[model samples]
Target: MKNLVFALFLLPTATVGSAGLAFGEDSRQLATLPPPAQEALREEMRDNLVALNEVLSLMVAGKVKEAGEVAEAKLGVSAMGKHRSKPMDARPGPHMPPAMHGIGMDGHKAASEFAAVAKTGDRDKALALLPNLTSACVACHFSYRIR
Candidate 1:
């Protein structure tokens, strides 16, 4: 059952790997922000993606707690970005529209949830939550683009 769960998670990530794209975006448009803001957001997201990779690698290696540590520290609410215009939060103060901020916040929430589940060191439970986490990524990408 654990193998089945892990394999199910691996299938889509492997497909994403072979497709040479992140989160299955064949083509996506840039969000119309200033160049600097775009770059800042892009860098932050790139870092987050790298962190996600590390988390997955750790998960595959049976380092579930370590992965959870990384998730809480790097992918949680406060770690998304410290943008100049606005912080990415569920609140209405960010430069991003409420919908965009909501999406970003949801991503953060998913990461936090993953961290919580991973902490238990139950491989099956952690693996089961994998899609919930990745789906947040896919949803964010589809809803907004970085320049």
Candidate 2:
């Protein structure tokens, strides 16, 4: 089951432009924000990537609880235990388009579900959720451009 899930997870890259997936432009133009705001967005995304790495390591080490905790605390859509993306409306200067915000929120929602499933120690279910969570990332990346 794990192998199957893992295989499906890699299917998009192997499928040569799968129609169900979104393909993003190589370069995306973001709104003109002050240097600080740009930095903040970069930092937020960086932290998210870091947390993802941490969770993956923990899960691989048979630390599903820790992985779930990290996901709930750091990866959830509204997670704010530490660095977090500011609300779109609250951000200074121009913000992401509404569609971008929606996709981001969807990613968060997927993360939240993944964390919840992980907490149950149901490896199969947790593994199943992984693809869904990651698909949100793929979809968002396909649909958005950040410059």
Best by lDDT: 1
TM-score of 1: 0.69
lDDT of 1 by residue, 23-141 (tens): 55546444466555666667777888898899999999999989888988888765654553463432222556666666677778777888899988888888887766666566556
Task: Give candidate 1 regions above 4 Å deviation.
Answer: 1-30, 78-81, 84-93
Q: Give the runs in model 2 whose Cα sits over 4 Å from its true position.
A: 1-34, 80-94
lDDT of 1 at 104: 71
Model 2, span 1-147: residue lDDT tens: 233334456756656665445365343335555556567767777887898888888888888877888888888855732323555443532466765666666667778888998988777777777755565556555545555
Pairs that collide in candidate 2 are: none
List TM-score per model, in order.
0.69, 0.69
**Model 1, C-alpha of 68: deviation from truth (Å):** 0.5
